[model samples]
Target: MLTFQPAKPNQLDAIMTIENQGFTPDEAATKPSMAERIDRISDTFIVASQDQQVLGYVVGPASDERYLSDNLYDHLTANNPADRYQTVLSLAVAKDARDQHIGSQLLAELAKVARAQNRTTITLTCLKKLVPFYERNGYVNEGVSDSAHAGETWYNMVKTL
Candidate 1:
């Protein structure tokens, strides 16, 4: 069985393992940055584990705007929990766990939590090719994103709760 739970700071290495595998060096967050996020806003960070080993995870934070800004990724700060939208920073599934539905399950749970907290939307940015994946899971593509992270073009996607 898979167990999903709130991420803890001590599990930084585990989360990074997946992050490194899923993203490029420029796109992947540094250890300190990722740790700070897990430390500062763990309520929005979750992990997927089986037999006590983390296999995937999702990290998000509340934002005042509907779309994610470049600054948010550079500096994750304290936020207004009452914000209308939840900005998902990243979702990673280990290489070995790619074919499984763990990523979808994490997104689903995050949506449920966001709705319960009165968040109107859950937003994310992904490469153009991955837009359909998010769409299949209920997110709407809002056209090209302003982000040029890792020199890769991305698109804005959102799921209205």
Candidate 2:
């Protein structure tokens, strides 16, 4: 059974492997950045595992900002329970786990956490091709995003709690 739980420091290697596979070099978070997030925002950073193997993860920090800024990609702050918005920095499933709804499940888990915290919305930015996937998961396209991360265009996606 796949279970959702807080990300731990020991899962860093698995998380980094999936991160590299799911995103391009420029777009993927570095080891150090991932480490910082794991240490500082475990409350919002969750992983899906079964039989002691991590299959996927969804991570981000709570924020007052409604949209993701490019700076957030490199700099992260600890989650503040009082923040009104929950932002998804990454949502990735292992290659072998694709087509099994793991990504959607991860998002659902994050939504549960956000709702419980009384957050107003969950926000994320995705490449053009992934916008539809996020849309099906309940996020609305807010058109082109100003984020210049990875030098690629992104669309703002938000789901109101």
Candidate 3:
């Protein structure tokens, strides 16, 4: 059984491992960067664990844009309650755990939190190949994203809360 919980500082290594394996070298957040975010706003960062072993995570900040700007990833600042939207900075699952719908579960939990905070929408940027995956989770494709992060084509997806 997989369980979801707020990420702890001690779990940085686990989270970093999953991140590195899940994304290409340029797209993965650095260990120190992940550590900073985990320590900064743990309430917005969560992990999927089974038997206390971290397997995946969903994390980001709440912002007032229909789609987050490049600066959001530069530093995950404090979540502002007045923000109209919640942006998912990263969502990934372990390769070995791919078929279990863990990503969807984490997304559901994140949506719940965003709604509770009165955020009007949830948004994210994903590769074109993953558009259908986010679509299945109720996110609407708002079309191409301007982010050239990792030098990959990206698409913007949004879900109204």
State the C-alpha lDDT per candidate: 0.89, 0.95, 0.89
- Please provide TM-scores, in order, for all candidate models, with all chains considered together: 0.97, 0.98, 0.97
lDDT per residue (tens digit) for residues 1-161 in model 3: 88888899989988988898889999999898898889876888989999999989999988878886777778777788899888888899988888899999999999988888899899999998999999999999999999988888899999998
Can you list the residue pairs that collide in candidate 2? none
List candidate 1 stretches off by more than 4 Å: none
**In model 1, how large is the Cα lDDT of residue 76?**
81
Q: Which stretches of candidate 2 lie over 4 Å from their true place?
A: none
lDDT of 2: 0.95
lDDT of 1 by residue, 34-68 (tens): 99888887878889999988999999889989898
State in Å the error of residue 130, model 3.
0.2
Q: Which ten residues in a row have the lowest lDDT in candidate 3?
A: 68-77
Judged by whole-model lDDT over C-alpha atoms, candidate 1 comes out at 0.89
| Candidate whose TM-score is highest | 2
Candidate 3 segments whose C-alpha is farther than 4 A from its true place: none
